[model samples]
Target: MSLFDTYIAVDWSGGNDRGAKPKRDAIWACAAGEEPVYLRNRQVAEDWLAARLEAEAGRRVCVGFDFPFGYPAGFAEHLTGREDALALWDWFEARIVDAPDVNNRFDIAGEINARVSGVGPFWFNGLKREVNHLPRKGLDRTNADFPEKRLVEMRAKGSFTCWQMAGAGSVGSQVMMGLPVLARLRRKYGAKVWPFEALDSAVAFVEIWPSLLAPSFPGGMIKDAAQVRAVARAMAVMDGQGSLELALAKGEGSGAEGWILGVGAEDLLEAAMKPIDMPRPPKLRDDCFALPAGVDWTPVDEALARLDAALRCVVGVEQVSHTQVVGRVVAEPVTARRSNPPAPNSAVDGYGFAHDATGEGDQVLPLLAGRAAAGGAYGGTVPHGSAIRVLTGAVLPDGVDTVVLEEDCSVTDTHVAFRGPVRPRANTRKAGEDVVAGSDVFAKGHMLRAQDAGLLAALGVDALPVFKRLRVGVLSTGDELVDPSQNAPPDRTYDANRPMLLQLAAAWNFEAVDLGHVRDDRAALKARLDEAVGQCDVILTSGGASAGDEDHVSALLREQGNLQAWRIALKPGRPLALALWQGVPVFGLPGNPVAAFVCALIFARPACLKLAGAAFAEPQGFMVPAAFEKRKKPGRREYLRARMGSDGVEVFASEGSGRISGLSWSDGMVELPDGAMDIARGDLVRYLPYGSFGL
Candidate 1:
């Protein structure tokens, strides 16, 4: 029913095959993405592969074979004739994407003739095609002594590297070869390379067995294997695995070579890229639109428009309790009922009295009678040259203008000598001087920050009601996905989104509950959904949200709920599905871990907060440039993962949503919109702080 039934793998070597040697040199067999089927010996592996292809007549299959389709012809001339004879042999390996005629052999016999007979003499004339090859004995196509001599020479100096784009002098390898580049990549790109075994397996699944007789595309990277695995796991957040898978399936392209992205996107991208041990430098491509054709590039209004439209859906003016006011926007116009410090009591700890009330500086006015503490009033008015005692925060008598400190007045027989000349309003606080009781305190619809909270406390409010936190139910699917809490195999890792989602929900005022991860099977997912609908106001699931052959989320929704949106044109979170289940919004996030986290931040986080009665704000990416060149498809918006770059804007690198490093390293992500921007190096852009992920 699919394009290919089975895949084949062959690890090829120079000359005839490993059978020509003492041991097995080729890894030959069937492999979908794992162990190969090992059909026979190196040389024989090809024949067995040919037979397998023939056995499945008319059906197309993918086969993975290891060999440099072209090699240095001097290897053959070195075996049989003089050194100058190398001129008669032509090099035959090197390739460009889809440029088949450049070096591919016309047939097996022709390849043998070219190698053993030095058929393409012109290749050696140009120094560019020099290569190292080994031949086997008794093989009609090659001289028996050639391989041994070549190997000896290789041991002495030259080394043989597999013909992946890495060794092809491609942009990626070029960037990787430099020490500065390596440091930058690790510091910036992190690890995003895939292993030979993994790549071989993916190709094999496509039944490239016929390729056993041929060479593979040799598209592997020179990065730490462990990092590659980690990136793959991270990529699970978004359901996207690698460059090829996302390119072919979602048509979301990564056509650039280098890029600097905001931190958030970098984290999301890291989650999507396959993990490796150390960071590897990636070559950038230009399959996207550069900012305008010159300088003066500005953000397209449509992008802002899109952002605004989305925001409008959930943002609203709403009244909220002062207790619940922290971080919530005030929707109504608010005014302070009274000014701060409504009345002036005492500025110092000393008694209050009339001006010239001090003896030294202020007259020491004797304590006639203590004025009541705050709120109690003095009944009678005072005469000229008089003072009254007042404590801190106490109400002064009606007749008292001010009170002099006891040290300032010479008190004798109730006649306190007011030393200094009396200034009517000097020491006394006039009524309405501290504050007018009718001023506005705060406005409505404003986001309440910490200072705002303090203001409310000062206003005498102890407990308050805030907008209720949104309650979100979390779920995941796929039989391959497992609960990380329990033990798992070498291939298994714990589910990451549940905890991440919970944290994000908390940050955004959404109450998140873990509903557990499930399998791709419909019945199980449905059962989980049924449980979720009863307790949660919003339902969120990671994985099984795409349209893969085995994916079942859509089918389950059709059977049990109402699906509103299927596939989105959005990058990194393309497989996102939105629906209404039992009147509660359901966000079927992509199964890929990276996509899940990013999408949750994008849609689910805001939606949950809005449902919880909190004002909604959209999270956006900044428009920084490529720290390095980045590749992308022409049409869809690409989410590139990058670091907070030393430059302070963003430094773009690997972790392209296909890699986990993108999400992990990024403080935020840069939006590589479809037509206007390329995220090239040194561009000014909007910096979207990791917006509103509750936790």
Candidate 2:
């Protein structure tokens, strides 16, 4: 119905046709049009693909390829040396989502590639990468060999077709092996990728990202940082990730060892090529890109660099001990400073005296008259056959333990009639009963909450020193951006981001100072940005951040700010940009209200927390049931503003991030089905929970 008449994705692979091996090797393809069909096989794969393109010629057709579109710096040597290196990526990055980077450097490609080299039982499946132990309707199960060996054999035969390149174990393995790096690179350097041949049709049709007509960063392997970044900047245009925003301006690592092709990869790859010269850098070919598998990007290495850089900047915040400060981000772990009860004290308002030793009713005894009132202690011992008079909060006199209430005791001038003697230490609050001294009450990086404040107060803490919040600046830019005082233009509309942004910033506990909106003029925008630097810690700009001719933010930013990453291969919020200006971190939020909100949730909110010096600031979304049947293509993540409906949480059918109305109809955004999983009504879907999301 739309301009994209059909979207087809092909996953073509080699079939061992000598009858000795079954052409079970698969090459998948799909076309989204009047009718969408998925094709798998070398013979049928290309003809079907060419026919669809012809039928939909002149119309935008989207396709996905599972082959190694670009290999390492020198493919011939790299492929020859490594035994089907692509097979190693079967571990988790691409297929298994949420696989955390728990250890040293969790490089999905490198890790899996290494394992596949000499393995008995491999971890996962390739074809339908989602092919777990469970059987599906369309797939015919087969014992596919390790992707690395598959590629080595294919490359040896010199018979590598696009189909073989796409569906062979190498193609399936390497493409997927390279998936995380590609995803991150798409984030690192905005790149508009051309899919090879093996993607699903409906899902492949629309440029998939966080917005409409957005392209899923066609994945590719690049060797140079400059190239990776260059591609990222360019991709920003196609995907609307983040645009450079200099006019609205303001301010401002990980794993090791494999699939690394650019810059220093030669040293390692060279050693890999020439065994004796291990660890030395390689001299890679200029034309190709490196595969990320079998590579190690040590976390320790990056963390050291980060720490080295981090320690350079003297932390602006002051750390105060729990005993000295009332509210602070606990720098050092805090142990209970003192025992809650200095000594045994009274618990009740009733009398505090040594009653009869026997269980008797109202025993008349000589009241060893002594007042151990809370502040004024009697500091004396009591003898037998006598008692001491004490108030509720009084410390018990020596030799006279426990207390009898006035109701349980009778009064006399010097003698008192009381109930039988109570148990030892009864009616008394014990020492250290509440909190033991020297035990950890709070851990390092604990954010002071309300109850924590009260506890600190009770511990005799006054004004507690806390980490100073990072100063953040917000600037909105656009030709149509007018303040409340400005008169309306014939075609201009009021900026919808400022008020909501201000409110959202405040909600994150950021000391957000609104720089107001700057007109389309570059000088004005730059001036506003310069002024903001003196007053803010980070700068945020909306609107004029795009590459459009009228948009000045991009050009201004390119002067000093490298567009590190923009345009996500997802929907809504894809146009967001993350950049650095004058060493300060700047985020370019899309002008669309809904896009801005969702992007802010993903990027801005986290950045604010990081700058706020609050480790507690986190963006963790939840999974809830979808109240309605929502359909989507594979390859791109989708964010749909959804309300916590009566059933669970129904996503608004109208999920255009550009549409402000969708935001009003939902509680928060739902991250719809990721690649491979088709979301049906009533199925639980991943989403940013209402708590983490700021309206």
Error of 2 at 608 (Å): 2.3
lDDT of 1 by residue, 516-615 (tens): 7777777888778878866677778877666677678777775656553434456777655666665556778876777887777766665555455444
Local distance difference test, each candidate: 0.44, 0.48
Candidate 2, position 566, lDDT: 50
Model 1 misses residue 336 by how many Å? Answer: 6.8
TM-score of each: 0.45, 0.48
Candidate 1: how many backbone clashes? 146
Candidate 1 Cα RMSD after full superposition onto the native fold (Å)? 31.4
User: What tens digits encode model 2's per-residue C-alpha lDDT throughout 1-695?
Assistant: 12122234343333221122222233333332111233333334445655555565444444444344333222223334532222222222345333121111213332433433332112333244442232222132232322223222232233222112222233433343334433433333232343222222322311111111112222242111112222222222111111112200111110111211111222221221111211312221221112124533222223223322322111244323222232235544655545666667777654554444545555666776557888887888877667677777777777666676666777777877755646666677777788766676777656576688556534433223355445567788877766666688878877779888877777665566888878888888777777776677667888767779877777677665665335454666555555555556667878888778776776666555545545524446777787778658775567787778778778777765667887777777777644656667678887676576534
